[model samples]
Target chain A: MFKVKVYVTLRESVLDPQGKAVTQSLNSLNYQEVTDVRIGKYMELMIEKSDRDLDEVVNEICTKLLANPVIEDYRYEVEECVAQ
Target chain B: MFKVKVYVTLRESVLDPQGKAVTQSLNSLNYQEVTDVRIGKYMELMIEKSDRDLDEVVNEICTKLLANPVIEDYRYEVEECVAQ
Candidate 1:
């Protein structure tokens, strides 16, 4: 099997209101040292070994379903794993 | 400054309906090799240097704000970085 970990984050140029709200909440809670916050999504996928190229499968999945290309960027790492 | 990356994930025993939905969507789209999916939150915080211990600050933030200890687990990595 293969273990794929994907991270999807907002584009740097995009406004992240959710992140700003979290930052304000933290500051109000007395974490004044926090200067900024950015929030993203993390996903773990377990895939059975197949003839398809791992990178191709991962890239297609990220582009099609995992991220919104216009506003989000995604990257992934794949590792071989022993299925339980 | 310190760059902190935090990952908050559902506890192993918890049900992840969002993940299950995504998995079903993928299977319908023909990515049948995918066996399991788990979704989580990823956050990045830029923190200014302070008198308080870094670990203590991070731990408190994770426990009090970033994660729900009853159903989620969190881990973080901190690195020294030059402020822009």
Candidate 2:
């Protein structure tokens, strides 16, 4: 099997309200060292063994569903998962 | 500055409806090779130059706000960011 780790984040130009809220919360907690925060999505895909080119499959999935290309950017890493 | 990347994942025992939905969507899109999907959160914190131990601060933030230890697991990577 393949373990695919995906990260989706808002584009630099987009404002992230959730990230702002978190930063404010941290500041209120006395963590004055925190300058900024950006919240995003992380996903793991347990892909069954397949002969197809993994890169192509993953790219399609991320572009089509995992990320909203207009406002978000995504990247992924794939690793072979040893069977038990 | 320091760039900290945090990944928060649901515990193995927890049910992930969002992941299930994504898996179903992939299956419908003919990506039959996908076996399972797990969704999580990714956050990036930009910390200003500070004298405090970063690991300790990150640990506290993750536990107190970034993740619910009862249902999720979180890990982070910290890197120094060169000033522009």
lDDT for B57 in candidate 2 is 95
Docking class of 2: high
* Deviation of model 2 at A3, angstroms: 0.5
Q: What is the lDDT of residue B39 in candidate 2?
A: 98
B34 Cα displacement, candidate 1 (Å)? 0.7
TM-score of the A-chain for all models: 0.95, 0.94
Model 1 residue A39 lDDT score: 98
lDDT of 2 by residue, A1-84 (tens): 999999999999999999999999999999999989999999999998778888999999999999999999999998998999
| Candidate 1 chain B: worst-modelled 10 consecutive residues by lDDT | B75-84
Worst 10 residues of 2 chain A by lDDT: A46-55
| lDDT for residue A61 in candidate 2, whole number 0-100 | 95
